[model samples]
Target: MTILLTVLGIALFAFGLLFSIAWHELGHLSTAKLFGIRVPQYMVGFGPTIWSRVRGETEYGIKAIPAGGYIRMIGMFPPGEDGRLEARSTSPWRGMIEDARSAAFEELRPGDEDRLFYTRKPWKRVIVMFAGPFMNLVLAVAIFLGVAMTYGFATQTTEVAGVQKCVIAQSENRDNCAAGDPVSPARAAGLKAGDRITAFDGRPVKDWATLSDRIRDTIGPATLTVVRDGKEQVLHATLAKNMVARKDADGEVVPGKFVPAGYLGFAAKTEIVPLSLGASVDRMGDMIQNGVESVIAIPQKVPDLWNAAFGDGERKADSPVGVVGAARISGEVMNLDQPTTNLVAMFLMLLAGFNLSLFLFNMLPLLPLDGGHIAGALWESLRRNIAKVFRRPDPGPFDVAKLMPVAYVVAGLFIGFTLLVLVADIVNPVRIT
Candidate 1:
């Protein structure tokens, strides 16, 4: 049964991936058509076409390999000097430029002269290129907000889970109540487990982080508004200064890093709790920031990735996960001994994260990416404006075809990195268990 569920989970993840790819392409297709740019093919994958049908001027289809997708817009790249679309070049770099320019016009129809993508205004071209990644971002935001506001997140609440019998400095790394240990404030104040702290000194607190910060910053006498047995009650306690683990900006305790802070003597209860729309947006913002940071840190992590892939190194939990790794995790998530809602939430969150990563990856202003084309259009716009300011002749469209060589190099590096990640995923996969 577990094996069957795992297979089913993999299939489901693949379907979701295909849908995301198709949705990304659909953005390009729709925006291109809206701008009167002729798109010949809207493919949801690479390699040979598995299924296809003619829709208007476009061949909409799914390819056998469900890796990535594209939409072939007519005249994606501008022509060379003297309208040289039929250039034959022996130079390798020149061949790449010519090849890209030639492929852009291969599907040119009888009436596609005015409908070419490069013929559109710079702003229109920018929108056409930006639409793809924007769609992924939209999908990511929708999924994240939906899950966060409805299914909720695993969060530490203001409710007390446990009360310590005696005060022990967090830096001491000991749990026992020793002979000379002081009585904990919570225990001395008669604060028990299951008590829901509503406020700190009449200042209403909704989350654990706020309560913790308040407790940490406080010393001497303090009052807590708590609810016990369906009745609101006030508890008086003297917060004690102790050596506690220092908390980072995100309120996560830093291990092995101690500082003098007021100790509250109670642990927050953790549970799944839904968030408001404002809180959901804040959470989404954090996710976006973290995703950006992860992308920025990828280069620095290459050595560690290499070690984990080929050496007898530990595959850290925070290691980068490729498609294979993610799918395997999805399978494991499906087979986890959890409730149905929890499992579905985990799977959906994984899909949402993939979409978010897609948005970030494709938005890189390098060749062969949606961002590269957008950058080209923006650069073109900048040049035309500068020319107009100086009263010079129009510089015309920036030939993005000239950057084909650069794009090739970028694509090669990306492919190599992807393959490395793929190998690591297969050999030392990051597992939930």
Candidate 2:
């Protein structure tokens, strides 16, 4: 049964991935068509076509490999200087440039002269290129907000789960209470397990973090409103100062670091609960920040990923996860010892994370990615505006084809990194369990 569940999970994830890829390409296709740029093919994968049909001017198809997708826009690059599409290359680097230029014009139709992508205004070109990654971002935001505001997420609530028997400094790290220790403020206030805190010091507490922060910053008499047995009750207690684990701005405790703060002496209850729209947006912002940080940290993680794959280093939980690794985790999530709703939520969150990763990854301003083209357009627009202001001759469209050699190198490095990640994923897969 577990094996079947795992296989089922993998299949579901593969379908979701294909849908995501297609959705990404759809953005480019729609925007290109809207701008009257001829797109000859709208393919949802790489390699040989598995299924295809001619639809108007475009051949919409699914390919054998479900790795990625593309929309082949006609005349993606302007003609070379000297008013010609043909190229004569005497060097290898020039060959790369010519090859790229030739491919960009390979599907050029007669009427495509005016409809070429480069003929469009720079800002329009930017929108056409930016649309793909923007679609992914939209999908990610929708999925994240939907899951958060509907199915909700696992969170620590203001409800009390357990009360400390006595005051103990975090540095002590012992469960047993010492005779010299004072009674916990929670115990003295008669706060018990299952008591749901509604307010602190007359201020309504909507979440655990707020209540925790309020407690940490206050060390005197305070009022706590609790709901026990469906009845609201207020209790007054004098909070104590103690050395507790220091928390960062995000309210996460800093490991191995303690600071003097107000002590509440009780652990918050953890449960899956829905968030308000405001809270969901706040969470989305945090995810975006974390995603950006993760992208920035990729270069540093390569060494660790290589060691984990080829050497005997243990696979860390924070290790980068490739498609294979993520699918495996989805399978594990399906087989987890949890309720069906929870499992579904986990799967959806996995899909959301994948979409978010896709958005971040493609937005990198490097060749072959959407952001690179957008950057080129922006640069072209800037240069053209400066020339117009100076009453100088138009410099014309920036020949992005000239950067093919650099693009090739970037592509090679990306391929190498992807393969390394693949090896690491298979050898030392990051597991949920």
Candidate 3:
């Protein structure tokens, strides 16, 4: 049964991934068509075509590589100065200028009035290119809203729930705090499980962030004021340094040396609240923003992840995973003896969050990405306008093909990283129970 469930989960995950890639490419194709741009081909995946069929003016197909998809548009870049246009009745320079103009005005084809991509206004072109990423963002928001409305949302309260005495090392079967796991700082300072931390070191502690900031910023002993049984009381405890491993939102370990840190082994009381339509939308926006911020911060946090994976006696490279990792996780979640609705909701949330990360990563203004093309388009537009105003020859559009080398380097790095993650996931998958 487990084997069958795992196989089914893998199949479902692959289906979802393909659907996402196709939808993302469809966004670009649809927008281009709406703007009257000539799309010669719309294909999902890359490499040699596995299957293809021509429909009207567009060739639809699938490629062997399942990495991504694209829509091939004519005159995507300015024509080279080969003087080929001069062979025709029109002057070469005049033809080049007309092609540039036609590139911008979606209404005009190559031979028609100057309506090329280059001729279109920058803002319009920006919108057309930006629509693809925007669509992904929209899909994420929809997924989040649907899941949250169906299963409600988890809300953590300030009240403390439980405190575990000793932190166990799973690999070595040793207690991290062998000396009877000294009383938690909060408990030692007179705060009980139900106590609400109202303030720390004389600063107001409104939420988890405030409480964590107070603890981390403090060098030594501190006073914590808590509301217990409806009365505020001051508790005193000396903060001791302890080593703790940290993981990012994506479950990747932060590479770094272990720093002696204040320890607090406490869980918060969390409740689920059914959100109103407006609240769901607001929460979805907040989640999307948080996801974007996390994606932007990944590069900076890589070192920390590495440290946690290696320094904490955890295998660093064992955490890498591809679609197989997603399948395993989803399968595990499904096998849990819980309400199917909850499981489905969790899966949806995970998918939405993952999609948000993928969307943001692809939109980075780097080579071999959708954002790179958009960046090239914008740069070319700027360069051409500047040259025209200065009465100089057109500098021409930014050639995305020129970034092939950089794209190759990025692809190599990604391949290596994916393998590493896959190994890590197989050997030491993160589990929550």
**What do the candidate models score in CA lDDT, each in turn?**
0.92, 0.91, 0.65
TM-score result, candidate 3: 0.63
**Which candidate wins on lDDT?**
1
Off by over 4 Å in 2: 202-204, 220-223, 232-236
lDDT of 2 by residue, 39-108 (tens): 9999998999999999999999999988899999977777788878765779999888888888888887
TM-score attained by model 2: 0.95
Q: Which ranges in model 1 have alpha carbons more than 4 Å from their true place?
A: 202-204, 232-234, 248-256
Q: How many backbone clashes does candidate 3 have?
A: 32
In candidate 1 the C-alpha lDDT for residue 302 amounts to 85
Write the number of the candidate with greater TM-score, choosing between 1 and 3. 1
Higher-ranked by TM-score: 2 or 3: 2
lDDT of 3 by residue, 237-321 (tens): 6665556544454433466534445765566777665677887987887787776777666666455445444445353332323
**Which pairs clash in model 1?**
none
Question: What CA root-mean-square deviation does each model show from the true structure?
Answer: 1.7, 1.8, 8.3
Per-structure clash totals for the candidates: 0, 0, 32
Displacement of residue 40 (Cα, Å) in model 3 is 2.4
